[model samples]
Target: MRNPKKRGAAGNSNRAHGSSAPGVASENTDGGYNAGMAVFSYIIGGIIVWSLIGWGLDFLWGTRWIVLAGALLGAVGGFYLSHMHGLTSSRKNTGDRPAAGGPSQDGGTNAK
Candidate 1:
């Protein structure tokens, strides 16, 4: 025979699984913030790499402005590329839901 207290505890645990549990909040902690960080890191990394390459080329060619120009262009391009890629990837990951007349896992229309 089970102890009365143990049986009560088990019953309470089962009740917790029901949908009406209080103090439950549904929210995603990981989302666009991570994507933004990834883009920033990519841009900074590209800028550093290009700057180094520019410095090396400048040293070899004895032209300082060439290195500066290359670094500037690389930084701008890297930022744009990273931003575009990050936006596209985020959308692809989250926006591929079915359209109208498609079956949804949640048994609801995909209209949004």
Candidate 2:
């Protein structure tokens, strides 16, 4: 047999303290913000690398358009590669596979 008065008291206390439950943890406590920043870093790294290359080429050839092209290419390619590899691989490693019958980010289908 359960004590109804004890249960009610517990619930009332939880309500008073703005708590959802006795021992349940919240969902926003993970490292998602860090992961997002890391991805951004990768994109920025690609742009810097390409920019340096373009700068060197310009220095050698005395042109002004190569650096812009390099920056553009770096941004696009970096984002694509990061989306395809970084995010998907992390999800796959964490056992959260993609949707069914769809191409996943890890170069494989999420078939059951």
Show model 1 residue runs off by greater than 4 Å. Answer: 1-30, 88-112
Model 1: per-residue Cα lDDT over 1-112, one tens digit each: 6776665655666444533544332243344665576667776777788888889989998988866776787778777887676543543435666455746677666667
lDDT, candidate 2, residue 21? 58
Which residue pairs collide, candidate 1? none
lDDT of each: 0.66, 0.69
Candidate 1 TM-score, true structure as reference? 0.47
lDDT of 2 by residue, 18-65 (tens): 336544334544446655765687789889889889989998999998
* TM-score for each model: 0.47, 0.49
- On lDDT, the candidate that comes out on top is 2
Cand. 1 Cα-lDDT = 0.66
